[model samples]
Target: MTAILITGGARGIGRATAILAGARGWSVAINYVGNEAAAQETLEAVRAAGGQALALRGDVSVELDVLALFDAVQAAFGGLDGVVVNAGIVAPSMPLAEMELDRLRRMFEVNVLGAYLCARQAARVLSRDRGGRGGSIVLVSSAAARLGSPFEFVDYAGSKAALDTLAIGLSKELAGGGVRVNAVRPGLIETELHASGGEPRRAQRLGAGTPMRRPGRPEEVAEAIVWLLSEAASYTTGAILDVAGGR
Candidate 1:
């Protein structure tokens, strides 16, 4: 069976992708830093969708945690066929100058360094040169990577921009090995992340501003990620798909 790992699978895009991928017959490993309740619910949803699911608690930013998480998934599933680098966080809304050092460090630690570590591990196990069948790696970036997020989250935006670069570079480095690396940039999606950003109503406030007249749903972004994780996108790689409804 095809086995895949999804970081930050407790809620939002990660949760949606886990459920969708499960329904598609992929065994799933969900990595969450906290929120065991949400993660448990997501685990059940994956099972309900008809796939074996494992929920592992770990901070993706820490090397030991990332290693343990992947190790646990490898032990449970035997091998990995795909991975979703979706684990990330944002601080309360503020200007760059007003943001604290801890906030910036934590932001890059998880959003940038954490993603880098996860991708590196995925490449190690999924590369054909490493004696394993190749697989796909999908990084969940944000539209902020392009728009810069201005006064709200320049640090977060910068981290995601780094993710885009990593995806593009890794795609070329791994294409010959049969592994696909791509990214999905979600716009104003209706997810709980807004609350953490100190603007729970942000999506609602910005919905009409987008051409679609509505903020996107997590499921919409998941659809793009699911496609990238599937054989249907066999010829596609290094693509940064925007799930942003023309925002």
Candidate 2:
């Protein structure tokens, strides 16, 4: 059976992806930094849907945690077919000058470093049996990387921009190995990141600014991620599927 690992799978887009992947017959490993209860809830949802699922706790920013999480998934599933690098952190929203250096660094630690670490691990585990058979890596980026929410969260945007380049470069590097690397850039999703920034209504404002006039749902983003990992997108790699609703 195909196995998939999704980081930050306890809530929001990550959680939705885990559920969707499970429904599609992929044995899943849901990794969460904290909030074991929520992770368990997600685990139950996957189980209820008749998919084999496991919940693991780890901080994606830390190398040890990333390694352990992958090892655990490997142990449970025998091998990995794809990975969704959806774990990310957004520091308090503020202007560039006013944002604390530590906060900015933390965002990079998770958003940038974490993604590279996961990609490196996936590279090691995936195989190259033929010209078109290999694992897939999907990084969760933000449209803010291009839109540049200057006054609100420049640090977050910069981190996501780095991820975009990471996806492109790795896509080229791994193409010969038969592995596919790509990204999904979500525009304005109603997720916990906004709540942590002290503005639950931020999604509303962002939706207003978007041409769609409504924020995208977490499931919408999750569906895009699952599609990129599926066989239907076999010829797709180094591609960034923008789920921005034309933002």
Candidate 3:
């Protein structure tokens, strides 16, 4: 059976992907920083959807924690077949000039650094030269990366842009090793991430302006992500797919 590890798998796009993967009979290892309750709920939901589940608590920003997360997945699932670099954070809307050092530091630390850490570990374990079966690595970026998210969290936009570059470079780096790397850029998704950014209805408010005239659902993005993780995208690599509504 396919075995996958998804960082921040407790909620939003991560949670939706876990449940969908479950429905496909894949073994899923979910990593969450806090909210064990949400993780446990997702665990049950995955099982209910007919897949095995494991909830691991870890902070992606911490190297030790990230190491343990991969280790735990290996122990629990025997080996990993895919990884979703999805754990990230967003702060309140603000111009670049007004942004505080601590906020910028934390933003990059978790978004960029944490993503690199996860991608690094994924490469180590998924590379064929590393004595493991090759697999897929999917990074969850954002449309903000392209839009620049002007006047609202440019730091977050910059951080996500890093993921886009990571996906491109890492895909080529691992292509000969039998591994595939790609990223998804979701736009105006209705999720708790916006509330965390201090704009609870940000998606809904701005979604109307998109060509699709609506915000995307987590499940919608999950479909694209899970496809990249599946054999359907067997020959696809170094691709950045936009799940945004043509914004």
Clash count per candidate? 0, 0, 0
Predicted model with the maximum lDDT: 3
lDDT values for all models? 0.94, 0.88, 0.97
lDDT agreement of model 1 with the native = 0.94
Task: For residues 11-82, write the lDDT of model 2, one tens digit per residue.
Answer: 999999988988887898999887999999999988777678999998988999989998999899987889
TM-score computed on alpha carbons, candidate 3 = 0.99
Every candidate's CA RMSD = 0.7, 1.9, 0.5
Q: Which tens-of-lDDT digit does each residue in 1-247 have in candidate 3?
A: 9999999999999999999999999999999998999999999999999999999999999999999999999999999999999999999998999999999999999999999999999999999989879999999999999999999999999999999999999999999999999999999999999998899999999999999999999999999999999999999999999999998
Where in model 3 is the C-alpha error above 4 Å? Answer: none
Error of 1 at 208 (Å): 1.1
Total backbone clashes of model 2?
0
lDDT of 1 by residue, 69-170 (tens): 888999899988999999999888888999889989999999999999999999988899897689899999999999999889999999999999999999
Residue 215 in model 3: shift from native, Å? 0.2
* Clashing residue pairs, backbone N/CA/C < 3 A, model 1: none
Model 3 global lDDT (CA atoms, 0 to 1): 0.97
